[model samples]
Target: MTDSQDHFDVLIVGAGMSGIDAAYHLSRTLPDMRFAMLDSKDSFGGTWHTHRFPGIRSDSDLYTFGFEWKPWTGVPIATADEILRYLDEALDENDLRRHIRFGQTVRAARWNSGTNLWTVTVERGVETVTLTCRFLWMCSGYYRHTQGYQPDWPGMGDFTGQIVHPQHWPQDLDHTGKRVVVIGSGATAATLIPAMAETAAHVTMLQRSPTYYYPRPKRDELATTLQALDIPQDWVHEIMRRKFLQDGKTMVRRSREEPQAVAAELIGAAQAYLGPDYDVATHFTPSYRPWRQRVAMVPDGDLFVAIRSGQASVVTDTIKRITATGIELDSGQVLEADIIVTATGLTLSALGDVAFQVDGAPVDLTQSWTHRGVMLTGLPNLAMVFGYLRTSWTMRADLVSDYVCRLLAHMQDRGAASVTPALRDTDRDMPVRPWIDPENFNAGYILRALDVMPRQGDRQPWLMTQDYFDDRITLPAANLEDGTLVYR
Candidate 1:
């Protein structure tokens, strides 16, 4: 049964980092435009709110992860608590809390071409609520929020230890003086080993394969120096942001041009941290090239230090099965442990898994093509934010927000209510590719769910470029009058 009907000029989904970024831009640019934000969770912080595992921190620097308008005066790689505090401050300072409706999960949205409106169906508790909006902005992140990816390993009826996934970590979980085994070699496992080693009797990082690990200082010396000079916060932010972005670009370029040199440098850094006798080549060297998957950040070489001090150790082998005591390896080795932490990767969920329809006909996102990495082909007045993989997610989020604002202004100027990206005759025959090329990024999570995502064309506007520098320059100067985007 329908409980209520509400209307707005724009409806923004998910109040996470991307959603917050969109709200900030929309409020600043289109103040008069009637807009409302929806978050499935009760609170504002999306990822920060959900991920409460031990040693949870940002992989990217705070200068870039933090909003462009809001300067983060904290460590480069901030903890979950610090990030949450920053988000809370942003929410209060901007007065955005008033516009957000908590516990409203959008189930489906239908586009009415004749009326130039989207009828959105949201599940609010037991009753269904309907809302109409002129435009839809999807800020929900691209991952399953309720669960993390956990593979079913061969096991007996029970293991003596507590098997836990970091996503759904128990608050009262006690690992003190207990032997802990953390599975997987991603960010979560890297973070867990060091922190758990502090209290645990011993921590073992068991990995099926190696991952690229880069150790960086928690604090930025240049940022501190600029602050010491009495420079404004915004100025310092801008300077640091640009420098980091440029440095990232250089690193990517170097990785592509001189893969061996880059790999060697990374291995050398890990060897230095773990000591010369450590097996850096076996444990730290990845089979794939650098940045193929995200390079895990080890702040202040904590993981290596933990390993060096004999608090933690790394094991490189495939798991055969889970025994009552611990996991048996393919090499006929058994790891005895009291606790097992499955730090497995995430499962991808695009656009909050909402179903779409166009005047009663089902709209399949997998069949559609992306436009400027934001809007989809044939989807009118809709924008979905998917950030860059190589750099800070907020960097791309800022650009997308600016572009959407420009688009809204353009529509208003033209007195247009419907603006859709239409496939022209020239683009009809263009080669369509997967959403993200496997060659570009072969991360297990992405590859596992690539078929469900929207496709990308080989040409401009339709092509999804992961390069932040390219997007920063191209998205701003993009002509609204381009024939590809039909404004009615």
Candidate 2:
């Protein structure tokens, strides 16, 4: 038990946005505490670093996604590279780059309640390292390390041509002039189909089911002008952030209350881009309510333009099998293709599969109850910060970070050893949904987390308000007087 191990007051398991934010606050408030951040990859920015697929951009606007302390001066809808650069800048600005240990994957973390510390085991190449910390923060974003989900299709192995998954898009795999079929109707499919159409001989987007699509402008002119004019960056960020949040909230509300109207308007606009003959209902109409899952965002309607120009096409049908020469549909139709891109879907992993332990017992997250989609009931001295599917993720992440900081500060003031969400509620009749979407559809990892995540209060603190203004008050500003959170 007394093996040689580096000990820290706080140990962060990721160097991405959440980890960076935690480090920033800890450094400012608890500067005397030893802190170190470890990441599995060779760099910071977990998702931004892992996902290198073409045409990958932030679906959410930058305003709400921007950090509270750091104003995002870049364009509203930013590319993945741009976001990575921004994250790199944040690390440098806060002098957090040196404290990070790259290529160190955390295998497991065990909590010794008696010692009041966590023994973290990590793998770094050939060597295994163990570290100890008083507090552990998990920030390895979801989706299980960029591995794409590939369902076994009948006759898949029979096809001689190359099959590609979006999560592992091969850089050298040339598809020029090759008839390509992209499967799945999620965000990735919408993004890749349009971009791939430019060069592929012909592209077909095959969707197992339809999804609601909304076209968003690529650039916010007001945001760009303000940034250029040397205006207060936070001011611009705040205004634009509020506008976008309101826009998204309105869309969600309208989709729920006036599903037909909203659906018709969106379908009409999308169909106008395509021809009158294109089957919008078959390809675009989803079975769930609008905003039930995150509505796919299309900037500039590039997909629409691609379809309109006859460069790409959408096909909504059940995939029966992958024939050597083409794809067989459930309707008894076979479409020929030279190459197939299974933009199928991604496998959802729980907080990057971080192994959790309470009192030396392995924690099964599926059996745990989510508290505010950020913390877990009965999970002590820990919190997870993944965003929601319905609203901008950063909106909740920012709030959670502030709240966690405040909670830490509260623990310090009270001379408490640790804090946790206590499961002392007497209400046994409370409903419980799966920890995430159990069906494994591509509705997005964050959205599924919200469905099972706990609401703040029935009426008092207010439920998980996706709205930034309400969250700012309830999380960062509201009194942490709730009995559910205990300090000891």
Candidate 3:
């Protein structure tokens, strides 16, 4: 690979699903435009490559997670390795290998408004290099290479037991014969508890607040049975995909309309499955609406059964402080533990903490509102691609990539210098809150970029249209010169 510094019409940071999708689209649609994709790691799959926690699998099915052009061939909910392979194959098929600069971490990007270009600084190995580009599309997914969010508990320093964070799971850390207490009831915690129960002496999931958990069928037996009855694999996938969308959307809508009813019904189902002794209200009832935060999907209520069988337990209490022996609750109860897994939550950042500048002035992302959650407001010749949390993130990301292609073509045809979002009065335009886990700002990643991110409005696109069928018409085919977008 040539190490000589080069210039490109567009520069993309992070070669994750979003970056890869953007690069592929840019390469195909704007073949004449020079472009480069960078990754801090030496691999293409960003999160998939980095996150190797036990039983880690995508929350969404693959039909939505995969690219429109590239269909998913593996299991519906793919493993990390399978997802990585699919990403690699996508890059290979699209001939994007040469365009990606791996092991290069972007330090800062300054936009020169006068020159109408961005000067990007990247650290590769021991040397720092600079790249100039006409446009910068930040595809760096939320978290940077910084360590995961680990809270400074009161007695963390005194605890002699092995503490593990899902982010940096030590390969040598042994869980055998250990009584583990996994903190946080998010997806990671749900995944960890059952897996650890199989080997550990006991596993307890401690949560300050209750979470909504749904039992999702793992194999889609009906779809499989249909396939055996002579249904084509593609047909099976499409049927199952539609069914999932219908059911998911219905639950989300009903949950918002009648929170208490939905909560009660869910609790009833859980109690029926787990049998009475478990405190379903305290451990399963969330204070927020059903879809306020993402609901963890447990396959076949496996988590509930794990707790029912005495292999695992769920404790609903505020951690008053951390003790050397165990986590102390506000009620003064301390459950001893041999291991602690702080599956607490993650901290999210915009552009993966990569700096941005418009002309000479530094871009204060907080001052700007997101333009359909894809591009920053008032930024010209730039766009970002982030996936959805409710549905498959990749589905929205892939559509955004295609839209960027169409947008690039529109700009080229009209000889436009730049495109930016036209800010409107807050009263007229509704606010949008991103559909992410609502952990404390300091405790997780979402804190850094929350102010900058648009708040979800009560309306359609302004509110994250978690549905793909709606976004297809709105994003890919929608008029580019809509009043919200301005071309320079």
Per-residue C-alpha lDDT of model 1 across residues 217-297, encoded as one tens digit per residue? 888899889989999999998889898888889988888889889999888999999898888778998998887888888
lDDT of each: 0.90, 0.75, 0.76
Instruction: List RMSD in Å for every model shown.
Output: 1.6, 3.1, 3.5
Q: State the displacement of the C-alpha of residue 249, model 3, in Å, after optimal TM-score superposition.
A: 1.6
Per-residue lDDT of model 3, residues 1-488, tens digit only: 22336677888887888898888888888898889898899788888877777777777777667776676655566677888888889888989989999999898887766666677899999999888887788888766445777788887877878788888888787888899999988888888888789889999998888877777667777666766787666666666666767777788778778878887877787887789876787788777777667777777777888999999998888887777888889988898998999987776666677777676677776556566667766567777776766777777887888877888888889987777876545426465455433631123345544665544444433444556667877787677776667776
In candidate 3, residue 268 scores what lDDT? 82
How far residue 438's Cα lies from its native spot in candidate 2, in Å, is 9.6
Choose 1 or 2, whichever is better by TM-score. 1
Off by over 4 Å in 3: 1-5, 229-236, 424-449, 452-469
Model 2 C-alpha lDDT per residue in residues 204-288, reported as the tens digit of each score: 9888888878886787777777778888877887877777888887887797689888888887878877779888888877777
Q: What's the alpha carbon RMSD for model 3?
A: 3.5
Off by over 4 Å in 2: 1-5, 224-230, 425-429, 435-470, 477-481
Clashes of 3: 16
Scored by TM-score, the top model is: 1
Q: Estimate the lDDT of model 2.
A: 0.75
Error of 1 at 471 (Å): 0.6
